[model samples]
Structure formats: structure tokens, C-alpha cells
Target: MITGDALLLRPWREADAAELVRVQRGDAALRRWTGAAVDDEAAALAWIAGQARGWETGDRLGFAVVAADARNCAAEEGELLGHIALKDVLSGDGRAEVGYWTAARARGRGVAPRALTALTGWAFGRGLTRLELLHEMDNTASCRVALKSGYERAGVLPAAPPEFPLDGCLHACRPGA
Candidate 1:
């Protein structure tokens, strides 16, 4: 939905399965943060398929974060820089959760925060009024992205999800707020 000089956010494609597998296999941090099992081709395809299902069901919309130079190509047809998504989407509620993973090569390049900003703006344009981002308390980088993306600290949870067994902070942003 958004494209900048360094990165762009676009939908997932079936052909991206191979790149997903390759990136997941090479980046331990990505695997740890995303909890995606794309070490194998089958797993990567299944992961993409599930995201498609989520899209069809209106549960979420997944986007590939690629270099902005890849913009004119089909979604997910560029260098696999990372992934971002609006999860737990509820059209009636006008809110969703933001989540992301940046590839090793893309880290420290402002990819996550920029992607978050674009995703937040896109979701708001699509009728969502609120967006939330939650990250482990120790995940300073994720927290930075949330703040830089204009999310405010909302609250803290005593425990995070199984993938990240630690406390977490919840951040939120609203349109025109």
C-alpha cells in the first residue's frame, strides 16, 4: 500500500514461497521473532497459503516488505526484505494489530518502522481507526518501530505469546490522534 525510497509493502504471492524459505533459513532472528517454520519448501508454501486464507477470511492482510525499486513488479516479486501484517482485523471495530519481521540484511535500515508507518496509514485509509503494536519488553527494536510509527504506549502484559516468553508492552495509534 505504501512505497518509499528504501522499501515498499505489498501483498504476498505464491511465487514468494521460495524466497520465504530462503530468508527464514538464513535469519535466526527473523525465525525467532516471526515463529515461521519456513526452513523447508513445504512449510514456506503452507505459510503463504495460510496468509492467503487469512486474507480471504478478513482476519488479516500480509504484506511483503521489499526494496522500493521493485515497486512496479507483482507483489512479492522483489528481494525479500521482510514482512508486515495487520492482524486481528475487525472491520466493524476499526482496529487491528500490527506485527512485522525484518530480514537480517534489512535490519538497521529503518525498514520495520517505515513499513509500520505505511501499514498504519494504509489500514486507516481502509477504514480502520486504530492500530496496535505489541512487542516483548526486551525487544527494544520493535518498541522503537512502534514509537517511530506514531504508536503510544498503551499498557503492558505480564506475559507474551509462546514464541516470545517474556513480558510485553502494548502500543496503540489512532487516526487524527
Candidate 2:
């Protein structure tokens, strides 16, 4: 687990499936960015299973963000703050893309950026050459997170908006950049 001052990033657990589903379902932000399909209990279960499979396959990894130092931000220690992922991994070339979401209660608290920064360092230390972050152009908050996490804007992808709506912005950072 990667520990931050106010958050911890660790592997997902079965016990967290319900909370994960709660965060994903009925969340407009998630739907806007991810078209989240974990809208029902069964889909949530499948999503958790898929993450496990991704871990086994070595192509993707998902981490659950929690309150660190037992802060008790939301009733108890290790409270769920959000989630982050490193996917579309190019193991041969040592590159990957990152995606993340901060829970409603955790938004504006720097959870996403801190989790992202830690994950970026971890991936790069494991021999990744670059890490990328992409988001809809209108998501200024996400843009801020990417920049604060040390990524530089690459360009806009005209094709990305059609699939998700709105133009897309790509940002990237090198291992030591």
C-alpha cells in the first residue's frame, strides 16, 4: 500500500464491493468519464472480479483509496476515499495510462492527485517509461489533478470526445520528468 498524508492506496478487497458499487452507481461524474457499468449488485461483483483478473494478467491494476493514519474522516479508519487505476499497460515498452475518481465526500481534498502521484512513482520505479492521463476537456478539476501529479498536456484527441462526449485532453509524464 502507498501511504499518503491523508489517504492510502491499496489493492481492492471483496469487503469493499458494496461501497465501491455505491460510489459508482448514481454518480454523475463517474458516468461522465467512465460510462460506469457497475450500476447493479451483479455488475459490481463482476467489476471486482475483473479487477482481480486484471491483476493476475499483469495488464492492469486497481487500487482503492482510503483515509490514512486512521483519520476517521467518515466514521472509521480506512474509510473509502476513491479509486485509481493503471491500465492499457504496454509492458513491452514500459508505458501505461492512469484513471481515477475521488468520492463525493472526498472531492476537493487532494485525494485523487496524491493517489495518482504515488501510483505514478510506483509504476515508474517498476520500469515504466511514461504514464498518461486522459480526460474530457470540460473536466477542469481532473485537468488540475493531472498537472499537479506532474503530467504535461500532450494534445487533444478529437476522436475521444465522440465516444464519451466532449473533446479529450491527453497528458503524460516521463519517469524522471
- For model 1, residues 35-152, the per-residue Cα lDDT tens digits are 6668887887888888898889988899888886645544435677899999999656888998899888789988888888778877888889889888888888898888887899
Q: Estimate the TM-score for candidate 1.
A: 0.90
Between which residue pairs do clashes occur in model 1? Answer: none
lDDT of 2 by residue, 88-156 (tens): 775678789998888788898888888998898888888889888999889899999999989999999
Query: How does model 2 fare in lDDT?
Result: 0.83
**Global lDDT of each model?**
0.82, 0.83
TM-score of each: 0.90, 0.89
Following a full C-alpha superposition, what root-mean-square deviation does model 1 have from the true structure?
A: 2.1
